[model samples]
Target chain A: MAGINEAKYMLGESVRMLKSGKVSNLISVIIMGFSLLVLVIYILVTLNVSIIIEKGMEEMCVYVYLEDGVNNSITEDIREKLLEIESVRRVVFVSKDKALEKFREQLGKNSDILEELGANPLPDAFRIQMKPESNASVAMEKIAQAATGWKGVDDVRYGKKWVEKGEKLVKGFYMTGLALGLIVFLSVIFVISNTVRLSILSRRESVEIMKLVGATNMYIQVPFIIEGAIQGIVSSLLAMALLWGVCSFAGRYLPGLGFFRFEGVIGFIILCAFLGSIGSFVAIRKFLKR
Target chain B: MLVYEIMPGEKRIIAGVYHLSKVLGRHFALQDINFQLANGEFVFLVGPSGAGKSTLLRMMYMDDIPDSGQVIMGAHVSTMMKRRNIPRLRRRIGIVFQDFRLIEDRNVFENVALAMKVAGIGITEIKHEMTNILTRVGLYHKRYEFPGALSGGEQQRVAIARAVANKPAVLLADEPTGNLDPMVTRGILELLFKINSGGTAVLMATHDVELVKSFGQRIIYLQDGKIVKDKEMLFRGNLRESISNSRVDHRAKKFTEHSIGEDYDGKRGR
Candidate 1:
């Protein structure tokens, strides 16, 4: 009966200390907020850059031209085969006459040259629009095989160098972003832990007095933990607000800047909140044990 | 009849520390000391500075562990006890310090209530008991006042109230009246006596030889970290002679009244 009452009283005292503003709750909140802010900015920038690379790849498609007198059935088969590959989105056929008309339109005064030629020498072509993540080199190789030994196919034209460079840039951004995020996360943890440690050091006398009064270690520790959690929550909110402001500002003015999808940005905000809380908890736990 | 009675001369051996030696880092704080305490006994421990009185008291409360020897409290041996068991032991033995280690953040009532709280007493009961104890210490009117605002004597009284709030079986006070005036000293001593008479054993360490000569029921004198004398008195006839021809000489006379200004400076320097 006595023990239970005593435990309840200790818990009440801990609550009182927390509410009285005696335990450096404000300092913790501020530290946590600042840390979350830095972390969120790092995350958002990394996310946006990755979006830009991926979107650029999707915009650039490859075009392949066929030789004169190429069999109609063979050309149709090649288009169908290109479509079978998962990377290929769709393929459209361009006839020889249509190609010649397009060339004439490109050169307004070139109609006389075309009439002088007296015959359509231009070749038909197929335009291949692939998925965003498609490997262009692999698609080209497959296309070359499909068109091999076919009569009248002149050549296959695709931007192999451009696709390779784009893919490399995307991968580089992803790796760099991942590495930067890890560094920022660790820095936040270090900062928060040290902040909590300083607070504990300043109030060691109070802790000693509590211990002498028969307060259990847990009773002594609860306020610090609460302070940490509160700091985490408040800091996370601040970080989220800052991120939202920057994103909105960019969205308004930087119209053509490819960035994180709106859905991904929202997901990142939620993730930041979770991380803030968890980081605070871990920081408090580490400091209190000491 | 008293509400609780400790049989006369029955001598309840509530706790004993045997041949305890404690080495903290490179310092030998307490060395091969032995002491025993019984229920309802009032004993004074007199020694000069650095005589290890506080260290001995800390061992009794299980705050510090002894490197060797056994500390037996009630039915349990302390050195073998787990950390979780130490609080239960502390609940039965209340300790008061000369500095009056009250939580500066809490008011007088909350300070007293903290002892009961750590012991797990219910809130309703904590309120009632803290009120009663503060009233007994004559500080009920100042219950809501913070410790920093109270005078030295009043702060010491609050410390006393906190120590006895849970009705501990034994009370250990390290110079409870060390910094108070004569009138306040007598009042604090009387409060301690009242508690002792109510069945809690009181062990107080003091440098006040005059006060000891006047009111000591039993004396345990320490010199150079050893018990030089242990005696009991049914009357003050022999005590007066013992005080007059004491072996220890005091170079400083009249026990200079260190003002509150000097008190803080002295403690801070230490």
Candidate 2:
């Protein structure tokens, strides 16, 4: 009955209470499954969409073409200046010959058409990649203004409109996901609280006896919180399993559906545990009063 | 050290109720009820069913707060207590009930052990104290038996063991023998008297006026939530011997006598 052993025993007793409340716990877990399912689907959408957006943003780069009859030295100077641009992450020069080869490869089996042409029509250009965090349209305008006024520079091009739209969509998606996630997190806590409340209610006599015998609120609360947390934990795991099954089945027809990593899944599970503990804590607050 | 000697005639009150008042529902249960229990005092609270003895006892243990007034246990004054300190206060006091109130899930030893466990007593010490208390109550052999297997009298013994396990400053018994037969009641009262002799102030609430009168000790009788009488009685012989010669011992002696004689009669008949 020393502090450590008493605490250890109380934790064990809480686990026993959860496991022994077969019908009630099963009902709680099922309710939790539905709640977590809502939460997990939201998390999955947010994670996968964020990954796709990151990949797309990585490809949002600018292409700067050089003037006709521009010499190699000027092209080198141009590349060095392009690197100085704040938004310009990297600059790769593709010569006339390499450009033609790339074009031929893009044409696939129609490369004979390019061979029939008397001279290579491809221009010497620098493929400019912007910084990952660079504003799409703003960076495009800056590079355009800088390159157009420079010697031997012809034009600067980037997919400014689409990239800007994508950024907006990503921001909106995250805001909505965050709001929805908050509501569902609170809902999950409520469910856990109800489950823990019922368990405490069933063991009301024990609580009274414990109070009579000098148990502090913390001592009485540990077991109920444990019961609720177990419910939260099991429910979240169930939601994850269900989500995994759906994703695996969907992955056959929809690519990138199963993009969630282990860390994301672990984070969700930890949140579920939090919801359970908080929920039970809320439920037992009134009972602890004198 | 001279605090007592300076006022040599003053009694050191270990627990007392000062002008205690309680209201249940629309009616006042207890009003201006004043009394003190000094160290080692064995007092009887004799009252009818609705006399608010239970309410007064609950206030003593802080199970219920009084509408007005204070309950003093040792140095603790209930009215001014900080909420966090109630558990510490309860630890200094022990309570026994008419129903035994032993946790059904635990066996006899565990029932007694819980009181000490809540006080964070070590497991070895809990076991040792439990053995001592259970042995004193003649229930050491039933230590592993569940309350369901115990008779009402044996269950009451387990309750007594639990209450006394922590060596509380004050022990409150509210109808502790109400559910037991006369013989068992005599044994329970004797155990209580023995505990009182060990310097634990005992305030027992019962309706058994004859038994209360026989104690020749301080008695407080409540009627309509008011203390009608608070005085000492006079009786013959010692308190412990009175219990030994009470109806319980005579019946038990007769029962043993009948068992031996019946065995001889059976052999002769055979």
Which candidate ranks first by lDDT, i.e. highest? 2
TM-score of chain A of 1: 0.73
For DockQ, the strongest prediction is: 1
**C-alpha displacement of B183 in model 2, angstroms?**
7.9
The sequence of per-residue lDDT tens digits that candidate 2 reaches over residues A1-290 is 23685686577568767666778888878888887787778777778878788888878878888887899889989999989888878889988889999888999999999878889886789998878787767888788888888899888777778878988998898899889889987886666566667767877877787788776677778887887677778888898889888888889988867546799778878877887877787777787873
**Per-residue lDDT of model 2, residues B1-270, tens digit only:** 112221212235567798889999998899999998755567899999989999899999888899989887765567676566667666667899999888887789877887776776778888777778988999999999999999999999899888888777678999999999999899999999888766566899998888778767889999999999988532323543433323323222222222233222222110
List model 1 lDDT by residue over A1-290, tens digit each. 23555456545654775586644667666666778778877876766666776667766666667876777787887787678877888788888888888899998875678898888988888877778666766766676666555465667766778777877877787888789889998998788777767766777777777677777666666555555555556666676777677777888886764445678656755665565455545654564445
Q: Cα lDDT of model 2 overall?
A: 0.77
Task: Quote the lDDT for A212 in model 2.
Answer: 80
TM-score of 2: 0.77
- Which residues of candidate 1, in runs, are more than 4 Å off? A1-15, A68-72, A92-124, A131-152, A256-290, B1-9, B25-27, B232-270
